[model samples]
Target: MLLKEVRDTLGTEVFSKEVERAIEKKVRLHFGGQEVYVKQSRPDPDERALAIRAEYNMTNRRELMERYGLGRSAFYKIIKGG
Candidate 1:
């Protein structure tokens, strides 16, 4: 089942202590025949910027970094073909 389905059907409490701990550590979970890969809610800034740049001619690095919550060095690295 999708994560949302799992959450809706079982409620957030269905996440056991082990699952919660795994999520905290950003680890995948294998429970009851399901392999759950927990991920961040937001896309990585560099990834988002790359997509935006590809789709649109984004020229403002500062604006893009600020909008995506990226550090200056990381943003530059991503923009510079990292």
Candidate 2:
């Protein structure tokens, strides 16, 4: 179920807790069925910036709408120094 669907169906108060569990379940389901293997992969400091932007672009519309209340969009727009 999509986050929006979950929120709409369950209401905000109940949905918050449910959503956390839902995400954990997804992560577990994805990994639990696979054979585990360790691999060394050093990350670059620049990667976090890339990841932040990638997440911002990919996050749900429901979250971005909430940003309007907190002026987060404006803050991001004027963000000069990371």
Candidate 3:
């Protein structure tokens, strides 16, 4: 399906079935077995930083640590400037 769509978009005059198959093979070969990490949740670094900074106080340090699942060192680093 994808190959047919690509061939349609590129035009069969330039990319025939054989050419499309070869390109697909090369692409799979190049990208196959690669460890891919896709972020599951919304990752807003700036917003998170602001929230952390606003919420980082002396009293609720443990709460912040627990909410973010960070160790003391990592939480401190993140608040400081991660």
Candidate 4:
């Protein structure tokens, strides 16, 4: 499920506490010495656009739309605009 789905299901505060407990339990049992680095930055918009453009040019647009969960006309507009 998506993060939004999880938050909606469990509520934000409960979901966060559950996540913290899960991380602690998992790390304590399996990872004793390692450091976990979770960062705030993952997606880059410029890179994402380049990837979408590349896919639109090289792969099936239908598959791309499915992967993005975008409608045909909307996806086409985005591909053509970029």
Summed backbone clashes in each candidate are 0, 0, 0, 0
lDDT: which is higher, 2 or 4?
4
Q: Each model's TM-score, in the order given? A: 0.38, 0.24, 0.45, 0.40
Mind giving the per-residue lDDT tens digits that candidate 1 earns over 1-82? 4454655677677865566556645534335456657886987756776775664346677776777676888776676777
User: Which consecutive 10 residues in model 4 have the weakest lDDT in total?
Assistant: 41-50
Which regions in candidate 2 have their CA more than 4 angstroms from the true location?
Answer: 21-82
lDDT of 2 by residue, 1-82 (tens): 4566867888888878667688768978888878778797765635633544454654553464364332556435433225
* Candidate 1: regions farther than 4 A off: 1-40, 44-49, 55-59
lDDT at position 58, candidate 3: 71
Mark the regions of model 4 whose C-alpha exceeds 4 Å error after superposition. Answer: 1-46
lDDT of 4 at 72: 79
RMSD, candidate 3, Å: 9.3
Tens-digit lDDT track of model 3 for 1-82: 7788888898999889889889889968987888757678965867876888899887888998888776899878777786
Candidate 4 per-residue lDDT over residues 1-82, each given as its tens digit: 3455766887877778668567667767896888867687655756765677787765588888887666878776777775
Colliding residue pairs in candidate 3 = none
Q: What is the C-alpha lDDT of each candidate?
A: 0.64, 0.58, 0.83, 0.72
